[model samples]
Target: MMVGATIIDIGTRKALEANGASIASGALAQANDASYDIVSDGGGCTDAKFIISGTFTTAPTENTTLAVYAQPLDIDGTNDADAPETTRPTVFVGTVQVNNVTSTQYFELLAENVPWKANYYLHNNGTGQTLSAGWKMDVIPYTSSPSA
Candidate 1:
């Protein structure tokens, strides 16, 4: 299930806070790929934000998109490449617009009622362009917990 909003306008977004939970942040240098990746620990994670930047010598073609996907793994699935997308992965979880060669954009994923153990995937729909992403995953205190 989807959580939060499906809006792309960052104008209405307020500064995000992780509250008291631990956050894992890292640089994502992934290129266009056909496979999904287990980004990191989602043990106590509730949401994830992918801030993408693409710096190029020349401006890239217009309407290019860089996508971020979070696929909920099957309960009985093993952490391996063999777990095909059709079986347990969901594609196109979120995307960023890279209309310019030097583009900066972001996309966020928030879990619904229950937390999901999923892997993150990145892909660029266009070729001949170079892009990189910085990813941050936020852990929210479990709502049902007394301390939350």
Candidate 2:
């Protein structure tokens, strides 16, 4: 039985903010609104692990949560250059809550089973906050048996 995991660098160290724009109160913002081609590395994957990590320069209100969601894209035929359909429904993955504090803070979340070729976003559940640059989200595909 040979098991292995492959780290899919779909997107690394992607900024959570757009053009240094701060997330408004109780707003949902896409992580750069970029579409990742998960099919390249997601083939034969039995499961997927998602990791989102970042620091909040402007800390959110105490006890507030940041929710993560993903929407799968529909590719047209075999042409990768064609624009992907973005009308698909989004699925909730997971969320992380903030502690009671007003200073810069770090946070991380781990989720599983996120769909491939999906675009994800963050929903701010409290007052507006500014995320520091260099925030990242990564997806890791796992195979139960590599030799199968």
Candidate with the greatest lDDT versus the true structure: 2
| Tens-digit lDDT track of model 1 for 1-148 | 2455343312112222212121112112222222222233323434434433334444556666545545445546654333213224344455555566454434444433322554444455553454433323232222222221
How do the residues 7-120 of candidate 2 rate in per-residue lDDT, one tens digit apiece?
343233333333323455566656663544445655645355555555566556677776777656664543332222223225776777876555544556655555556666
Task: Tell me the lDDT of model 1 at 118.
Answer: 47
Clashing pairs in 2: none
Best by TM-score, which number?
Answer: 2
Clashes of each: 0, 0
lDDT values, one for every candidate = 0.37, 0.54
- TM-score of candidate 1 against the unseen true structure: 0.43
lDDT, residue 17, model 1: 22
| C-alpha RMSD for every candidate | 11.0, 6.2
Worst 10 residues of 2 by lDDT: 80-89
Question: Could you tell me how far off, in angstroms, the CA of residue 137 lies in candidate 1 after the best superposition?
Answer: 8.3
Candidate 2 wrongly placed segments (more than 4 Å): 1-20, 55-58, 75-89, 102-104, 127-135, 143-148
